[model samples]
Target: MKFPRRRRDPVEVNLTPLIDVVFLLLIFFMVSTTFETRQALELELPESAAGTALEASPVTLVVTERGRYRLGERELGAAELGEALSAEADQARLHGLVVEADARAVHADVVRALDQAGALGVRQVRIATRETQATSTQAETP
Candidate 1:
């Protein structure tokens, strides 16, 4: 009599269903989640109702009450004024000049800055002034 052969079944686990389930969960979460934009610092810029739109300026000259000159926070003497502005104008090619002067600044000094800008071929020049109740009060007092 011939002996019957015993058969053994192969052992394996199907991972396609598990991968599909994970992918579906990811897609569901992505669709349901809302992303909020955040900023490091919330800034409120000053509003000027009657102010004209400002164009970019390369050189900013600050004149103190005592007639001291400053080039963007750096103190510049009257002698270096022309040379410095010229260098900036040359580098920028087309440049603008903005003058921010104290209320008590010397008129001659401010005019001198404008003259320098003109000499440097800078066509755009503007004077900056503060707009506030205190400024109006100060003007009324004296």
Candidate 2:
């Protein structure tokens, strides 16, 4: 007597789940990633409610916490600072010069940057500052 053989089923991989997982991962990364415009120098700008928005982008002079001066991305000494300011003088006077000093930076450093700008004939010099937090003030009844 002859025995009958059973046929085996063909193997198949479902790609729908794999594609779904890939899309999920893509979405997760897009949502979780932070997009921040980071500058060459990190600064905690002082807060002020009196700051006015500029009409044009101007040359920014950054003063670090250690009283170091940074013109754009280039760090400069006191001697080199004058040359750098002079180089930017035309643009500084045309658009303006913004002094972005760290909150912890020495006041003398900031003033020195201003003096340099003034000496270079930069008339419009604005200090960079973040907006101050609004405070609630309730009138007291006597």
Candidate 3:
């Protein structure tokens, strides 16, 4: 003999509330999110809160101890430096020059680089300097 058939209740999950909550959260994050873009140089940058950010990329001129200017890897004389800097500034579309002079470099060499930038009509000339890092021994001694 077969037993009487029993009626089963169907189980259901309501997804409308869950979808609405998820959509609201996604919209909130999209509206409230902020983005920032920052570009940085690898060399040690001097600490200064008063410095102005250059609108154009800068050409770097490294002054050696022997009073020579190095643009990238090429060493140039004071006279040659001016021409090269002007050409680079034009080609690179840069409006600034950064003279990274070594501590032992001659004062005249640094001045000459500055003059070159000025002659090229580069208005944003800036000097890059790094804060002196105390040696481990020096720090320990104190």
Q: In terms of TM-score, which candidate is strongest? A: 2
For candidate 3, write residues 14-55 as lDDT tens digits. Answer: 999999999999999999996431222123344554555554
lDDT of each: 0.70, 0.85, 0.69
Which lDDT tens digits does candidate 1 get at residues 2-42? 98988878878999999999999999999999764213212
Number of colliding residue pairs in model 1: 0
Instruction: Evaluate model 3: give its TM-score.
Output: 0.51
Error of 3 at 34 (Å): 36
Q: Estimate each model's TM-score.
A: 0.52, 0.65, 0.51
Q: Is candidate 1 or candidate 3 better by TM-score?
A: 1
Error of 2 at 63 (Å): 0.8
Q: Which candidate number has the best lDDT?
A: 2
| Clashing residue pairs, backbone N/CA/C < 3 A, model 2 | none
Clashing pairs in 1: none
Model 2 alpha-carbon drift over 4 Å, by segment:
1-40, 136-142
lDDT of 3: 0.69
Off by over 4 Å in 1: 1-56, 91-95, 132-142
